[model samples]
Target chain A: MNSGRRQFIGRGGAMLAGLAIAPGMLLYDLAHGRPASGAVRWGMLIDTSRCESGCDDCVKACNKENGLSGGTGPADVQWIRKLELKDSRTGRGVSLPMMCQHCEEPPCVDVCPTAASFKRADGIVLVDRHLCIGCRYCMMACPYKARSFVHEPVHDQKPDVPRGKGTVESCTLCVQRVDRGETTACAEACAKAGHKAILFGNLNDPGSEISRRIKAVASTQIRADLGLNPGLHYEGL
Target chain B: MDLLQARRDTRIFYLLVGLGALVVAAGLVAAHYMEEYGHIVTGMNNQIVWGMPHVFAIFMIVAASGVLNVASIGSVFGKPPYKTRAPLSGLLSIALLAGGLSVLMLDLGRPERIIVAATHFNPTSVFAWNVFLYSGLFAFVGIYLWTMMEKRMNPWSRPAGLLVFVWRIILTTGTGMIFALLVARQAYGTAILPPMFIVMSFAWGLAVFYIVQAAMYGWNEMELNPAILKRLKNLLGLFILSVIYLVAVYHVTNFARHAAFERFILAEGGIYPMLFWGGYVFLGSVLPLFLIYFPRLGGKHHVLVASMLVISGSFCLLYVLIIGGQAFPLSIFPGYEARSSFGDGQIGSYAPSLPEILLGCGGLGVSFLITTIGVRALNFMPRDENTQAGD
Candidate 1:
């Protein structure tokens, strides 16, 4: 073969190897994801007026996404719950979804002996599976009762959401999807259900849709008396 | 007196040790099963994360601190009678702590991963501080015990005892703060809890000491000195009254800000009310006082009965405080009536399963086993001075 022809074949072989390794590198990037940026403080604003009391699309979406049993039993782990409330004096009825508030100073993080319950710089609260001793001190400390211990063995977990028995778990704000630059399963599902009540975005960006809407309305954090400064808010509640 | 009597004593000792060993083995097996099946086999859930095991473990832990007060009276306060009982007091403290800690460590969802607690510490966590406090208690108390037991170390016992005395208060404070530091819970979160726990420890620990001391004396067919008996019972009576006083203060203070919680704990909560009023107040406190202080009724057996009631009362009070505290619904929305699928605003329920009970019993068994072995091997018995209280 001519020298020029041989060089061209070698180049072609190198191109083939590159094609094979490209997908692997992309997967590696996905596997060991870049740390969530400090610039973005993610938050949610719920318009209770638009939220239907009977609708449970948000809950179902979360269960499906997180691979939870979604059972209503006392032992079953659930990330979100819908609360029905009636004012004692005025007889006014109200309804809203409840989950981890992802506080600025989370009590769970404060009480966890092993620092397993932690808050990311971006304000996402999470349990480090490797370190959690399952003492459930966080469960006791939480005013909202948002965290749940895995009471039974877990099976058929989503590959992205690795769950185990004998560990405390709660909403991660759909971290897997969030890391992939997608909105939470619950918020997406609620939007799909035509409620348009659940809005998720970066509160730091004043130009973002959630920020503009929050600015336009009076939104209140649940248990504002606690001064948890939650990432989630409610409007017209 | 005879070979047969000594042989009989050995047989009885073995029997007691065997019983304790059996219980410990069973408890360990139950814990193993819980680890295998997950907490699904246990009655504890997300709402009531702690159950019978915590009750037993906490009781032992709190009482362990209180038991050391006997030694403190001798070594720290320079009391003659309390000084005589100091060695046995030290032994009980160590034994009880061992049992309590064992149950606490084993009950974790990931009991095998408990080393993570030591490796990754959160400074803000009361539980983490407790870890250090508990180990410190063992170290300091061990040193204190050594000083008391060793001839050359006798002079050091006073300082060691002083250090242990101070460390134990901090340790008990850490235990009480486990609940007191919680910002949201109504049953806990009171500044008064640490003091309440301290007094409670005194009563509970003394009651335990009485029972054990009585047992040891009975085994040797010896009579407790009348003056020592009188002083101990009177001290117990005072501790009981202190406990009642603290309980009243706790309720009254809570009533002002948290009327609903007060209502739930005091009256509206069925078991809670019953446990507090009937179980703790009447049976554990009042009846015991009557038995201890009643004119012409201050027999040894009567005092023993009073101590028994006090011990049971401690359990009743703690049950109301710990389990009942969790049972009451959280006032997430103060003015609004709330309902939810996740038991929001509804009372959290718990019924301890067999494994949970066994795990707790196993912790007690561990204490018993250690005490039995320690008492048998060591010169822990108290010899009557044949003089009065001040002697």
Candidate 2:
């Protein structure tokens, strides 16, 4: 019995040692080869008071730009949305545009098993469609419920945008538009109205409108207590 | 081959597999149609973003993890009744894991790429560690069970089983930490989640075992020992008490401060209150306790019924936790209502679409089908070897 137990212990130790080695090896390579770096920090400032509840122009613009229908369905994706709200006590109604807040310390990035959900050097929280396993832990970990899983098979999937079933997706902060040195679709739409409810700039840059407004007003980060330090700021209480 | 036993087992296995396959196919077809039509097929939307599938998946995973408790008692502690029941306990652990993983795969958008999760390594991610832990734990249990099958148990079996036990606890912690560590979310943050998971695990694990044992025994197989049943019931009873205590403390402390979290979960108008009362407290925790502890009851079938109730309640617990956490909006905009941002002065609504349900259900079918087939092929349940000779 003693020998049997000893042998079991030894074998178990060996198995665990093997598991430990695999992760250790990966960490070594990551540390040596491709250390995380700084890139562009895509930040947004949304003045909720400026948003119109009746017109989903931002949602429409995003859908059109991303080849989506402004339809309400699981597969009918929403990159940007206008959500209605009412006063908690008095019951007065208003609308707020809901999208990915793109946190500097993103929970999705912290929970992804495949490193598919990552924060770009420039501070944009994005998902690598190719690498994403669609485990939805990132979705679960995301405090805002900002992430959505593509539950159905995709039809007419654009070549440029590789959306698929069994994968999670959310606001990419318009990576495609950013790649082209352009403003986000929603930001562009908000810009057209000259209300500037949506402001885009480098969060790191002090002179940027986002940074300036963040400094100028008593701006708040939604779920600020979460400690996610979201790059997106909402101004005007 | 005792043609009778072989034939009976084969027939049962085939029937289960066939039925599972048919349901899976039907679900897939429905899912395909729903996806094509859009997410309107099921009862979920932004308000109630989580529904039956989410509930089912969490239950399965919790149930899967719970199976380990029995295995640990028998294999690790070497206690009476539990020691004799090691082989059966081990087999049940694998079976429950199958059920859990199945739900996960179907719940996913890209279940096919699950393999990639194993291949890619993300150091900073808790979910990444979870995938690794889950794989290792499963492999260890599988091998340990295989080792125990031979008339001469392999020297490796005990240690492998022990490792699985330790790893499973860690895995359960990781699962809980997925919520508790979310400092960003108001609903979950207490240090109690890990211990809560542990308590929940034992309750869920014992409940599943009770039901499985009853089914395996048929109407009157009588293979299960009365002593074992008594011990298991006692342990389960203890777990129920712990679960109640922990839940009370978690809520009471949060409520004392009148925190938004407390208001969200306990207040009359909030979704948190509705789900906590409707799902977790009454269904999962309270009723099961009554069934387990009440007088002149807690017999085999009663225990089985109680276990089923616990399982159902546990599923609801996960549902309430996952969905309820997301119901509150992150932004605290000025001149806006505090709660209305979640939806139109209501909680965010969600229902699992057909594809989501199909995939979730398919995961269950797959888990059952796999366990049924694996047990038949791989000698999962331990044989007496020499029943006439006492240990």
What local lDDT does model 1 show for residue B294?
A: 95
What residue runs in model 2 are displaced by over 4 Å at the alpha carbon?
A: A1-40, A46-57, A72-75, A83-98, A148-166, A206-218, B1-40, B46-50, B151-155, B256-292, B324-335, B338-345, B352-361, B370-391
TM-score of chain B of each: 0.98, 0.84
Candidate 1 lDDT tens digits, B261-324:
8899889898889989999999999998998899987678998999999988888888889888
TM-score of each: 0.94, 0.79
Candidate 1 achieves a global lDDT of: 0.90
For residues B1-391, write the lDDT of model 2, one tens digit per residue: 5788778877877888799888767656654554454344656554444556666666666667777776677677765355545666666666667666665654445556677777888898876777777777678877777666765766766787688788888888877776677664556666778778877888887887777667666622546555455666777878877887887787787566436656766665355566677766787667766776788776767677777877777766676667765665443443455432224234555644556667567756765666566656654443333332121
Best by DockQ: 1
lDDT for each residue of candidate 2 in A1-237, tens digit (9 for 90 to 100) = 999999999999997787687854565566665432474577888887887667667777777777655666533456666777666667776666777899988888887888999888778888898888656677657766677666556678656677776567888777777766788888898879676688887877788777878888887787777688888887653
